[model samples]
Target: MENKLMMRLVIATEAILFISLMITYVYFDLSVGFTKQSINYLDIKSTGIFSVLLFSSSFTLVQAEKNYSEGKIKKLKIWLFATIVLGSVFLFGQAKEYFKLLNNHFNISLDVFSTNFFTLTGFHAFHVIIGLILLIIVFILTLAGDFDRPNSTALSSIGMYWHFVDIVWILVFTLVYVLPYLLK
Candidate 1:
């Protein structure tokens, strides 16, 4: 019960964090001119692709949690591996996009748009990195025979966190990638 309570607290904290970032993004966006010229300067296409990848990683993570709950260790392993791989792919896509943006001189220091853009997305990327690290730790635990129990609360908690990260990406994708294009 304490663990469950702690889990909820952690989740709530994460939700608050994302909410704050979203609010900051919206505030900054509205403060500036909503002109097509400003919108066209962003690399929306690359962001769109990264959004897709991040969203897909959420699906993979759900599968991992499902497998873990069903007591199918082998299936859980496969699904977790899939989640990790999808996450890695998403990170790689983000890195490539970042490099492209830098090469094109769309750096964080360029303007209000670039600064906010990089700050929001870069903070998200940092979350993804932390999620990846957690996944690896869980993977190692599973491999070391630490999750052989019939009902592992630790497994479920981590799974919840993984799903939460994915859900946060959904919001990020909508606000950072989709909304900008639509507003443009």
Candidate 2:
């Protein structure tokens, strides 16, 4: 019970941070207005694909948790691995996008829009990294026979964090990627 409560508190705090970052992003973006130079190289289609990949990971994670509860250890491991792969792919996509932006001279140092963009996404990425680490630790513990029906508290906590990360990404994607196009 305490574990669950603490996890919820942590997620709630993280949510506030993300909400603030998003508000700042929108405020700056609207203030500056969308210029061709501001978002010229943003590949919405590619980002959409990446978003799909990340969202699907959440589905896989849910399956993993369900499998664990059902005592299907092998299936749980497989689903957990799938979640990790999907998350890593999403991170790779983010890195690729960042490289492209930097190559095009769009960087955090450039303007308020760029700064907020990077800070928000970068913070989210950091959370993803933390999730990945948690997933990996849980995976190792499972492999060592440390997790069972009665020993799944840590796994459940990590699952909550993973789902939280996915939810935050959806919000960020909508605000940063989709909203700008619609607003324009």
Candidate 3:
């Protein structure tokens, strides 16, 4: 019971953090004097790809949790491995997009709009990286036979975090990719 409460608290804290960041991002974006010329260099298509990959990762993670609950160790590991691979791919795609933007001089220091854009999306990327690391740790534990128990709270907690991270990325994708184009 206490563990469940603690998990809920952790989720609440994460929710607060995400909400604060979103508010800051929106405030900065609206206050900035961004002409279409300033942000024309952004590669929205690449970001869309990364967003899709990250979202798909959450589905894979859910399958992994289901396998874990069913005591299918090998299947759980495979799904977890796939989730990690997809997450890595998403990170790589984000890195490539960032490099392209940098080459085009759309860096964080360029202007207020660019700064806010990079800060928001960059933070989301950072979270994704952290989630990947956590997933790797969990994967290692699974290999060590540490998560063989049915109804493992640890596995469920990890799944919750993974799902939350993906949801956050969805919101970030909407704000960074969709909103900018629509507003312009």
Candidate 4:
């Protein structure tokens, strides 16, 4: 009970953190007044592909939880591993995007757009890295027979966090990647 409550509190704080960052992005965007060409710098299609992987991890995680409830240990492992792989690839995609921007001499110091863009997305990527680390630790614990008995709410707490991360990304993706391009 205490752990679950603590997780909820942490998630609430995280939610506020993401919301504030997003609001900052919007506030700057409104002030800067970008031209249509600005959206062209972002490769929406490529990022969308990677976003799909991150979204898919939510499903895999639910599957993992389901398998755990069903006492299907092997299947749980497979699903958890899938979630980790998807998250890793998503991070890789993020890094690739960063590299592309840097190679083009685009960076946070460039202008308001770059600064807000990097601040918002960079924080999101940092969250993803944190989630990946947590997932890895859970995997290690599962392998060590820590979750075999599953007496309490260990797995579901992490699941809540993983789902929250994915949900935040969905919002960030729509705002940063989709809406700007489409509005153009």
Q: Root-mean-square deviation of each candidate, in angstroms?
A: 2.1, 1.3, 1.7, 1.2
Expressed as tens digits, the lDDT of each residue in 46-85 for candidate 2 is: 8889889999999999899889888999999999999999
The global C-alpha lDDT for each of the candidates, from Candidate 1 onward, is 0.76, 0.86, 0.82, 0.88
TM-score per candidate, chains pooled: 0.87, 0.95, 0.91, 0.95
Q: How do the residues 9-125 of candidate 3 rate in per-residue lDDT, one tens digit apiece?
A: 877897888888888878876776566876677777877887788888888998998998888999999999999999999999988988988888888888877887777778778
Model 3 backbone overlap count? 0
In terms of lDDT, which candidate is stronger, 1 or 2? 2
> Which number leads on TM-score?
4
Per-residue lDDT tens digits for candidate 1, residues 51-151, read 67777777777777777777777777777787788888888988888887788887888777777778877878888888788888877777887865647
Clashing pairs in 2: none
Q: How many backbone clashes does every candidate have?
A: 0, 0, 0, 0
Q: Write the per-residue lDDT of candidate 4 for residues 1-184, one digit (tens) a residue.
A: 7778988998999999999999988887888765565567789999999999999999999999898888888888899999999999999999999999989888888777788789888988888898889889878888887767555577788888889999999999999899998788
Q: Which candidate achieves the best lDDT against the true structure?
A: 4
Q: How does model 1 score by TM-score?
A: 0.87
Candidate 3: residue pairs that collide = none
Q: Candidate 2's error at 3, in angstroms?
A: 1.4
